[model samples]
Target: MKRIALLMVLALSLYSCDTDDDGPNLNFTIAEITGTDLPEYFEIGESYDLEVTYELPNACHQFSNFSVNPYVDEETDSTFVIEIAALISYDANITDCTEEGELTDSRTIRDLRVSSEDYNNYQFKLLTGEDENGEAEFLIIDVPVGEPEPETPEENTNA
Candidate 1:
């Protein structure tokens, strides 16, 4: 019983010491259309909530609050687009998205469009203190969400 108690205390201490600043951070937001399961289109001068995620290497400090801007690009008209931008740490800017870092800071971005062949694709990138190649960054998998078509009587026969 005494040994178990000691182990529990040690575990708690390690878990409590986890924090954010001790490593790199990550954050991003995705928006989908309001109805009919479509890609969320961005209009001129519109407001949208950007979901953000913050990752830390050391797990000693808490993640920071989100700072995302919902901006649109007028240069492209064939489809609606949304621009996601945020500042991440250098540690989070390693060759692999999961590299451990004690300190970091950089700009992360995602460019999406409503009417493109790859409309559901995300352009993930990380820009750190300088401009150079071999920079730390990783791209997330493409995710698509659409309404399921109603099954007809013939399709339901399997059930």
Candidate 2:
């Protein structure tokens, strides 16, 4: 009788050990940033629009929010380096999603003013994920000072 009781307990425990594997597998791809209306050269004290794009493994992965951190370094009096880091998050939801998904967003950079006396160029580094495991992309842009408007020739009023 004791042997039968032990066998029954073992069987019940084994049956209770079954776990559900219906949770969604969430993963993300590298995020990217691109200039939308920016020209080859950026004028001092001007605003420009930028576009940010990212993707998820599947539709089951929902976007929560994202944040970007910018770092600036002065390589020289005429050159500067800027690094932008992105932190993307997603919701852990279990759903039936088979198709891959993408997310696109926009941001504006206002008044790109430089205080350097001889500013000429800028190098941008865009990155995503943590410092330990992340990817970095680069973009180089030239900075040209706006041309001064020419003064119209005054008509000879004494003619």
Candidate 3:
């Protein structure tokens, strides 16, 4: 009887020790912002492709990617406000990220301002809904400014 009790205690101790497969928990890590290669500024009418990428948990192997096109019209006032729209998708197997209960279909943030002086900076923000694990999260990304454009050039007959 004592041997059986010892074996039971040993089994319980071993089970308690096995805690590696906790399955990605609420903790998350965000990676630095990443995206397409492009210039910082675009001509008034010209459209540019903008993509912003980041990691989940803010410090883990899993990542959350965001893609969008944010543009300002030179013809219009440079101090206009614009919205950053992105299509967010997720991997079902993602284990170590904090998200809302379910993957958000589409997220539209309101009142993102783009002041004229801010042209030198690119801002990226994330909005997360509930995943299987209940938690809210976000990531902020700043895109480095590229080289400045030359003064407006006029058409010349020398060409």
Order of quality (lDDT): 2, 3, 1
Q: lDDT per prediction? A: 0.36, 0.52, 0.43
Candidate 2 wrong stretches, greater than 4 Å: 1-37, 60-74, 93-118, 128-159
lDDT, model 3: 0.43
In the range 1-159, model 2's lDDT, one tens digit per residue, is 999999999999999998865665465444444433445566666655554444444444444443444344544555666554333444446445565655555444455555554556655555533354453444444434444457899999998
Best by TM-score: 2
Candidate 2 RMSD computed on C-alpha atoms after optimal superposition onto the true structure = 9.0
Q: Which whole-number lDDT from 0 to 100 does residue 34 have in model 2?
A: 44
> Candidate 1 on 1-159: residue-level lDDT in tens?
999999999999999887746454444322111111123333333333333333334333333433333333345333223333333233344445543444333222233333334232322222122226744343222223233346665655555
- What TM-score do all the candidates reach, one by one? 0.26, 0.45, 0.26
Q: Where is model 3 more than 4 Å wrong at Cα?
A: 1-38, 58-77, 83-159
Q: Give the range where candidate 1 is weakest over 10 consecutive residues by summed lDDT.
A: 29-38
